[model samples]
Target: MAAKTKKAIVDVKKQFEKIAEQFQTFQILNEEGEVVNEAAMPDLTDDQLKELMRRMVYTRILDQRSISLNRQGRLGFYAPTAGQEASQIASHFALEKEDFVLPGYRDVPQLIWHGLPLYQAFLFSRGHFHGNQFPEDMNALSPQIIIGAQYVQTAGVALGIKKRGEKSVAITYTGDGGASQGDFYEGINFAGAFKAPAIFIVQNNRFAISTPVEKQSAARTIAQKAVAAGIPGIQVDGMDALAVYAAVREARERAVNGEGPTLIETLTFRYGPHTMAGDDPTRYRAKEEENEWEKKDPLVRFRKFLEAKGIWNEEEENKAIEQAKEDIKEAIKKADEYPKQKVTDLMNNMYETMPYNLQEQYEIYTEKESK
Candidate 1:
């Protein structure tokens, strides 16, 4: 029999608020673009800072262009990426050239950093199989569209790295809603148990499509989900690139040193609808909420920081923006040059030894192609 004396069962649900507060979204730069945490700031040269800002600008522009292309019917499907540039791009800067990255759909920017050319990403959204081919020797996988699947796959990749005695770590990303998935728990658990080198970043963008995160889980912070797995968990202000770079850089250090996986939760938001495939944020999000998050835009804050330091100005920024646009236009041209996908080739690519049913279908496709 259990003995209960002078004890009240803690209300775990209510306690979530406290837990969330304790983790406290880490930030170096405030919304006003001031360094609030001097100690937490990463050592960055002016050139390095400029480079970081440039990447952020590039990623933001890429997102805007892709969404426009989708809206204009030039692209088949696209996931909006307006508000989470700092979270993905900054963490990517923390990784070495050899690191393996398993990305979610929202992680295309990071994938570009990992060697998926800009045009390839566009081709991917347009449903071209050629987009699936990553650059040579880039230790990155295609984007995982099944919410939390990348977490478990990252665990496996991390284990593989460890088994090979490699110094590299595998990093993966997911959203707040993804943190509620079973695979998310399983992936972190396995990595923690085996001390596999993996970094899992949950970009808690406040909502999973139409549903808010509060309705997704009772947990206070997505980072704390790593607690039960016995790994370090942290929360960072996703809007602060410097802070994100610092957090992931340290986590990489720990992982390569035989330490287990670390879970980093980034508090972020998506300024646009979930996907351009036909969704409307106006249906659920209040205009006031949107305006509030807009104030925290990573690009705006970083540009402010650069201006204050005298390392960046509007002319320089405009040049970078213009170059990014031109580069994107070139990539799109290259993507268009790919021989339009042949249906018969598609069937042939689907099999090594084709089953009779599929082979029969392949024959039909071949017959159609010859017509």
Candidate 2:
């Protein structure tokens, strides 16, 4: 008898690559500000479209002023938001007042729109206690600095919302690097298993500090990572505000409708270094590459789109820039009035009732402050 032909061996890596290819980056507007996907265009009113453009303009100015403050030693820690306005503000505009936001360090802009005081955000960068304090009515948490930890926390928050039968969703943001963390997988897995109303956003800005994302994962697309979690996943052009808003708005709708979680990957870029903490993008990123992304700037693209619709103009954009400048000036002044954070404040804030050991240390610091 002829030997049976061996079946073709499974090519796991190639199969995964094919799966990744299936997750196309969704786009409504192209790089030239032309509507490429007319069907995907959001049903936002003309006023809403103009407002989104205004906010994006404001955020660009905010990001510029923030970097200047960081260099002048007026701000403590800042992640430049220059190239991320569309990915940040537009997605934020899609949320309801009752939804919860668990943000990463780069997501202060979202928290601000979610009712966090601008002065408090300044204080947060300055390491002031009041900066971390959110108003009682605000449905948000202080931005998480421990990378992907917010993902796990968001899962818990969403689960709690589910248990309470509230029609609210919990959303979180983390960078491409954060997506590689063990907590990221655990959080998504837990949320998927429990059918929690959670939305996970991965801002794939191409780098995690100095490390390019390509070195972090073999997966071709970050959105495909959601497949393992058993949830819907999508990649959207982060440079298109309309696209981001539409995608997030739909995700929120599905979440509140009891459809469980969704993972969104925003294909974006950061114009400046990862942080104001001395790391420079110039070392690793090519100037040509930076210039290429500059041509697709979210602010520029959205501005053109709105201008074509006749709802936005350069004058209106300038007004938004001026308003952002004034607001930043006032916020920094307010932040200056906050008393400096103390070691004792850290100890006291850590627990509702201080542990005996911490209480002893708190007394020591208190005595020092008394002198």
Quick one: best lDDT, which candidate? 2
State in Å the error of residue 108, model 1.
0.9
Candidate 2 per-residue lDDT, tens place, 1-371, comes to 99999876998878876896889999999998999999988899998888888888888888899999999999999999889989999999999999999999999999998998899999999888899889999999988999899999999999999999999999999999999999999999999999999999999999999889999998889899899999999999998998999999999999999999999999999999999999879999999999999999998898888888888887998899899999999999988887888898887787889888778888888999888
Q: What TM-score would every model get versus the actual structure?
A: 0.95, 0.95
Residue-level lDDT tens digits of model 1 in 1-371: 88767655797666776667668788999998999999988987899899889998988888888887887787777888888988999999999999999999888898887888888888888878888988888999988999999999999999999999999999999999899899999999999999999999999899888889888887767888877899999999999999999999999999999997999999999998898877998998999999999999999999899899999999889988998999989998887887778887676677788888787888888888888
TM-score of model 2 (CA atoms): 0.95
Stretches of candidate 1 off by over 4 Å are 1-6, 9-21
Residue 269 shift from truth in candidate 1, angstroms: 0.7
Alpha-carbon RMSD, each predicted model: 2.5, 2.0
Residue 364 lDDT, candidate 2, scale 0-100: 86
The candidate 1 region of ten consecutive residues with least summed lDDT is: 4-13
